[model samples]
Target: MERELPKQVFIDGCEQISMEFEPIGFRFAKSGPHASRRAGDWAFKISFQSNYLNVGGEYVELVVHASVYSKAIKEWDERSAWPASASDWVAGGQLGNLRTPHHWRTWNIVNPHTRQAEIANIVANIQTTVLPLFERFDVPRKLAEQVACSQVPGFMFPENAVRFVLWQLGPEAAENCLSYWVARLPSPDAFRSERDVPTLPDRLALGSDTNNLARVARAMKIGLSL
Candidate 1:
């Protein structure tokens, strides 16, 4: 069995490659006493060359639970190999599994021409036909920035999944966007008609089947009752 390496070991190992990282604070289901602050749990972020990822050229944000570091050492016997698999590494989990989480919401883009035109043309259609309408949807202007950044002559995504990856947003960016949505949406009274309705489920992580979502629980705990 491999011995678990401490946090310092992990940080030092990453330092060799110039990977920058810091601990992350987590917000639980937002209910009861745990609602106000995410003081208990911790996360870490690592930045690497965009080409290292399956989705190249775009900056990738890797978020990992602190617990994973210890688990990784035990599993792989190397502090540098913190995430065990490529998929897990990209998806904010262990290194092996790279499955996209369901909580991530998406906007689908459809086009008639498949391969006759270049990717530039396809992206252009996405920008002209889909972007304006997406702007009207509950998603905010800042969140739309990611799609805008990727709209280039040869831009291509690894897959046709609708939503962009949350991890793709730098941790700071993700926090900023999430805070903006929580502050803006939820109360229908804030806006005039349902046309401008803010549906937070589209923005935040998905909730349980009952609609008794972690966000709702946290809201209640924080006294931001809806």
Candidate 2:
């Protein structure tokens, strides 16, 4: 029997996993190694990662990444002149990272003999771990709240969190979110000096300094006294 190329093996594994998720509204991308489901303006995606071992390897190690995106967040991102695409996800991390006792998780696909177990494991993780998190924030408002309150590292930054809340909720909620972030700071005077924070190009700077936050609020046409 001809040995399967690593890419083919990975692709086949992805296909199997996608099929498992299809009943839950996920559609596997025909051209990429990801599957996604759209819920209203939000999109949840599960993508496969693998370090393609040299050409003739029989085994591949795969990591699963899950992400969530929304039209509101994408629009906010575009205002910064950041390139926004259909896949402009605002929050997510590796599937394992979201689980308790967090640690990286990978599946090793050796061949047809071992592929079923690996695929089953990946599907189980998505169903039990990833989907519940995605379902918790099925709408833009819920997701914005999660980001603003927790500021999950791989999920989002405080700066973007404020913007997302502003878009999904309103300036009032945004201000409250900003205040929450400010209260978390070790020093109330953390944002006192504009000079302490270097000016960064709009596209490259997503800083949470007072000056930047105020600018972001003003850019959105809201009066923020920070």
Candidate 3:
């Protein structure tokens, strides 16, 4: 029979990792004191990643109660993989009253035979993989680029994230994302008015240059017509 792993295991593993690592702090958050099916929404958030994500290569900031996790040993069953995603791990978790953005991540580790081993695996992943990746790339802009190119379009860019988004999706799309409405217009100059395109702050705007996005555009054969 399958049994749900206690939430304490997650907390302990995260706590242990936080203690050993510098500049990372693990926090366990739940809505209320008691656990409920509805109130079961909780997460293990690492503060270091949240603060530094995107600056370097910080891709993720937290791990939450997975909608589903495997019940297996050390060996991962390749067949039991979750749907592939740019951000395949969970997101949309909250820290305190302030809502954190989509930065949650879950690893490919399968549930080990004993609860003790489960904790060890999680802790090791947090220390070795998650932390290193977070400090490096912050988060991959490709995930956001895919969303930008998809049918369901509505991801507002934070100021600092604009440059990275532009690098991935190209100038027109980046401007469209920053704009009130996303338009596949010819160029930044094509807009009739400021209202026609979104106004980007000086720091975020690409400023009449296609060079930054040139490589990405060339590879995808996008933005060549413009």
Candidate 4:
């Protein structure tokens, strides 16, 4: 059988958070039922994208979509600005979802008084975890290499992370940079002659040991076209 809808604790959690994580700007687009603020194509502070609130505020699911580069809203930090939705700005980028996502959640705590503490913990975890990802790779090549090498025995990225980093290296080098990410493979078995390699896949298929490199080829083709 399926799980129940949002739990009562989650509902209370949403009520507590609505005050802090309010939807701030224009409504450019709707990502599921998220509350988004937008400017042209740029959107941020989108909320409720992954969680739900049931009738009477009786149940709530711990859904969140906090962006890593939110600090940009206050001041300019060029590295954090990515996946620019609108055109370039005089002060640099005003909007981005640059890195892949990494969701943070709070577990159920039936006690009413402790809900605030749970929310605080979830926020703290996200703040501490996010920026370091950007620090690891300044260029897309480094990112592509990291994604390829991430298959190490103990390696694990945040659950919300994009399997492949979605960076915006710009037209001058975007195609070249995104191209490098496609060459990585699951195993040396992929080092076959072009005629010997089977048809390349059209999309990324996680947990598939084989055909990964082939999928990369297709990712490059599609990414370049975009």
**Highest-scoring model, lDDT:** 2
Write the candidate numbers in order of decreasing TM-score: 2, 4, 3, 1
lDDT of each: 0.26, 0.68, 0.33, 0.36
Ranking by lDDT: 2, 4, 3, 1
Q: What does the lDDT read for residue 211 in candidate 1?
A: 29
> Per-residue lDDT for 141-161 in model 1, tens only?
343354333321111221100
**Model 4, position 84: C-alpha lDDT score:** 22
TM-score of each: 0.19, 0.73, 0.28, 0.43
Give residue 133's lDDT in candidate 3 (0 to 100).
30
Worst 10 residues of 4 by lDDT: 87-96
Least lDDT summed over 10 consecutive residues: which range in candidate 1?
A: 153-162
Candidate 1 wrong stretches, greater than 4 Å: 1-127, 130-165, 188-226
Q: What is the lDDT of candidate 1?
A: 0.26
Cα lDDT for residue 146, model 3? 46
Per-prediction backbone clash count: 11, 0, 11, 6
lDDT of 4 by residue, 53-126 (tens): 34332333354543322332223223433322322221111012222342234344334466577677644543
Q: Model 2, which residues run further than 4 Å from truth?
A: 54-58, 76-88, 100-103, 151-154, 182-191, 194-203, 206-226
Residues 28-134 of candidate 3: C-alpha lDDT, one tens digit per residue: 33332111111122222343122222121212232422111112211121232211112222221222212123444543212434545544655665455444433
